[model samples]
Structures are given as C-alpha cells and as structure tokens.
Target: MKKVIVISAHPDDEVLGAGGTILKHSAQGDQVFWLITTNITEPDGFTVEMVSERQEEIKEVEKILGIQKTYLLNYPTMKLDSRIVNEMVPRISEIFKEVEPEIIYCLNRSDAHSDHRYTFDAVMSCTKSFRYSYLKQVLLYECISETEFAPALPEKVFLPNYYVDISNFIEKKLEAMNIYASELGEHPFPRSERNIKALATYRGAIAGVEYAEAFQLIKFIDKE
Candidate 1:
C-alpha cells in the first residue's frame, strides 16, 4: 500500500482542506498519516476545557478518517510567523523520514493564516527530492476560509490544477468536520457546512464530477 500524509496548520484544516481525498486514500488501502502543526492551549488564552475539547476532536477525526497515525508539533497557535524555520524544519523532516510518504497534501502557501503559510514552508523544506526520495507527489489543498480570504494579489491566488472526485465521501468528510464544533459556524461564516458543500460542488463543476476537492500540483516525480 502507498503511504500518504496530510499536513495542516491546525486540527480542522485537514478536514476543511482535503478530508474527502483522505477518505478516498484510506478506502483505496493507502496508509494515511496526519501532521498537525499547532494546538490550542491554556498558554494561548484557551481555557482548560477548550484545550481538552480540541484534543477530543482530534481523536474523533482520526477515528473517522482512518488515519494511521497523527503527529502533533504542538507549536503555539496563530504564532507560527514568529517562530524560526530552522527550529521547525528538523522536527518536520524527522516525520518525513519516518513516514516516507509517497504522496503529501499540505496547506497552500499563500493562505490567509500566517500559521498555514509557515506550515507550508516548513513542510516544503522537508520534500526536497535529493533528501526525500520516496516522495513522489506533493499537492497543496485549499482551506475554505483561509484560502478564499487570502489577499487578492495575482501571485497569491489559489489556482487549482488537480481534482479528486469525492462524490461518495463528501458526507463522511462533513461528518468528520462536524467533530470540530468550535470551528464551524452558520452559513455566511466560511467554515459553515453549507459553504463547505458549496465549494465542493463548485469544484465538481470545474472537474465534471458530482463532488470533488481541488488542489494545486506542486511536484510530481516519476522514477519509472
């Protein structure tokens, strides 16, 4: 079975970004791993109850998604920009060595959240072909709120060039995302379930599928 990894800045991002695709991978017998770059903590103004709830949510998501394992860097939430890449890269690289994933799905570099951007940078640093020969493909998945809210600069636009049909898995993806009750909101709020399904429908139109997840192809190495 092929090994796959999904790296996210926070817990709900994997669900928001590529939950359906991950489900597809697991159903196809690919071993899937999750790398969460940040966490909510008491030091970050979150209450003890809030911190505990988020941990529970992560566990629920792992079970629902069939994640083989989860690696949490536990970096301070929303403060990734303040951290040094030097300190981040080695820890992430170690996970790369252990997982040796053939396919990686990570947050878009130009996403609105600084944490997302920084996480992408660190993950990319670990994917150099010379160092991680097992890595065959790397793709950036778009998080609904973060990606759409990014500054509308030409360079920052999320131009999706790849699509994964997720018609059968969309409901399960929504089920997994609902575990993060604190993250979702009503219709107008970007993380709402309605909006999430809408985005999938919109992307499906682009790809001629009933429902799909869109991604930006960053790298693909063919050794054959």
Candidate 2:
C-alpha cells in the first residue's frame, strides 16, 4: 500500500480541504496519515475545556476517516510565521522520514491565513525530491474560506490542475467535518456543510463527476 499524508495548519483544515480524497485513499488501502501544524492552547486565549474539546474532535474525525496516525506539532494557533520556520522544518522533516509518504496533500501556499501559508512553506521544505526519494507527488488543496479570500493577485490565485472524483465519499467527508462543531456555521459561511457540498458539486461539474475535490499539482517525480 502507498503511504499518504495530509498536512494542515489546524484540525478542521484537512476535512475542509481534502477529506474526501483522504477517505478515497483509505478505502483503496493506502496508509493515510495526518499532520496538524497548530493547536488551540490555553496560551492562545482558549480555555482548557476548549483545548480538550478540540482534541476530542480530532480523535472523532480520525476514527471516522480511518487515519493510520496523526502528528500534531502543537504550535500556537495564529502565530506560525517565518520566525518559527527553522524550528518547524526539522520536526516536519522527521515525520517525513518516519512516514515516507509517496503522496502528500497540503494547504495552498497562497492561502489567506498566515498559518496556512507558513505551514505550506514548512511542509515544502521537507519535500525536496533528493532528500525524500519516496515522495512521488505533492498537491495543494484549497480551503474554502482562506483560498477564496486571498488577494486577487495572479500569482496568489489557486489554479486547480488536478481533480479527484469523490462522488462515493462526499457524505462521509461531511460526516467527518461535522465532528468539528466549533468550526462550521450556517449557509454563506465558507466552512458550512452547504458550502462544502456546493464547492464539491461545482468542481464535479468541471470534472464531469457527481462530486469531486480540486487540487493544484505542485510537484511530481517519476522514479520509473
């Protein structure tokens, strides 16, 4: 089985960005792993109960998605910037060595959130083909709110060149996302169930599928 990893800036981002694709990999017997870069901590103004509840949500989603394992860096939320890149890269690189994932799905580098952008930078640092020979592909998945809200500069645009048909797993993705009750909101809210499904439907039409997830193929190495 191929090893796959999904790296996100926070807990709900994996679900928001690539949940269906993650389920597809698991169903296909690929060893799927999660790397969450930040956490809600008491120092971040979150109550102890809030931090505990977020952890519980992560566990529930892990069970629902059949994640092989999860690695949490536990960095403070909203504080991941270039200042900590040196500290973050080695820890992430160690996980890359441990997982040896052939495929990686990460947040878009140009996302609106500073956490997402820095997480992407740090993850990419660990993905040099010569250093991580097992890595065959790296793709960036768009988080609804962050991606769409990014500055309208051409270089910052999220141009999706890859699509994964997720018709069979969309409902399950929604199910997993719902575990993060604190993250979702009513319609018009980008992370809402309605908006998530709507984006899938829109992308499905472009791919001529019932439902799908879109991604930008950032890197690919053909070892053969």
Candidate 3:
C-alpha cells in the first residue's frame, strides 16, 4: 500500500481540496494520513472546551472520508510564525522517518494565506534530506476560501495546471463538510456550506469537470 500524508492549514481543507483524490487513493489501497495545523477552538463563542469536541469532530470527518489516520498540529489559523516552520521540521522529519509517505500534498506557496504558504515552505524545506528517498511528489491544492479568490493584485491570478475529476465524490465532499457544524460564519453569508458548494462548482467549471478539484504541480521529477 502507498503511504500518503496530507498536510493542511485548516479544518475542512483536506476534504474540500483533496477529498476525491483521497478517496481515490484509499480505494486503490493507499494509506492516507492527515497532518492538520489548526484546531477549531473558539474560546468566546464555543467555549475553550470545544477543542476536545472539535478533535472528535476531526476524527469523525476523517472516518467518513475513509482516511487512515489524522494528526492535528494545532497551529493557530491565519497567524503563522517563521520559527514554527523550523520547529515543525524535525517533528515532520520524524514522521517521514516513520510513515515514509510516497506522496505529500500541501497548499501552494504562492497562495493568499500566510499559514498556507508557510506550511508549503516548511514541508518542502524540512524534507530536503529525504530529497530523492521517500517523498516523490509534493502537490498543491486549493481550498474553498483560499483557492476561489482572485489575487489581491490584478496580475496574480491563481492558475491550475492539473485537474481531477471529482464528479462522483462531490457528495462525499459535502457529506464530510457537514461534520463541522460549529463553523458558521458571521451573517453576511452566515453558513459556510453554501459557500463551499459554490466554490466547488466554480472550481469544477474551471477544471471542466462536473465537480472537480484543482492542483498545481510543484515537482515533476520523471516528466520530460
């Protein structure tokens, strides 16, 4: 079985961005693991105790998505430190020593979010020692919030080089998203589900699939 680890910046990113591929990988006998960098903790709105509850929420969603295992790093959302990247290196180095994934998928470095970009940088930098050993490919995925947006500057539009046909698994994408019931946004749009569906459709249209996911390829070793 091919060992795979998906490092995501926030909750629901894994499902939204790579749900179909994850399902496809696992169904083909790959063991997929998740390394989450954020915890769903709202001390004011949901109370501080919700972290543990959200932990359970993460697990349930992973199960529903048929993921093999998930590890939450509990990094703060939108706020990432440069030092944290160094800190994560050795730890992820250890994980690579153990799981030794054949593929690692992360957010693109040029993404809008700092945390997402930082995660991509750190994940790539840390694994240099294993350059041609364990990790063969590191692909970048687009999340609903992060991926669907046009660049703040006019010239910097997000372009996808490859697309996956997610027509069959879009329902599973929606199903997995339902687990994060506490993730309602402030009332301009209110619920995030509607937004998620719309983004999926949008990316789907861009990718030419009825419902699809998009990715940017970082390393194409054997490609000539």
Clashing pairs in 3: none
Q: Distance from true position, residue 192, model 2, in Å? A: 1.0
Tens digits of lDDT, candidate 2, 132-224? 999999999999899999997898789999999999999999999989888899998888999999999999999999999999998988885
**Which wins on lDDT, candidate 2 or candidate 3?**
2
Question: Taking the tens digit of each residue's C-alpha lDDT, what string does model 3 give over 56-159?
Answer: 77888888777877776767666677888888777677777778887887876666677877787778875563443767677788776665452655444455
Q: All predictions: root-mean-square deviation over Cα?
A: 0.9, 0.8, 3.3
Tell me each candidate's TM-score.
0.98, 0.98, 0.83
Range of the 10 consecutive residues with the lowest summed lDDT in candidate 3: 182-191
- In terms of lDDT, the poorest run of 10 residues in model 2 is 150-159
Per-residue CA lDDT of candidate 1, range 10-64, in tens? 9999999999999999999999999999888898899999999999999999999
Worst 10 residues of 1 by lDDT: 78-87
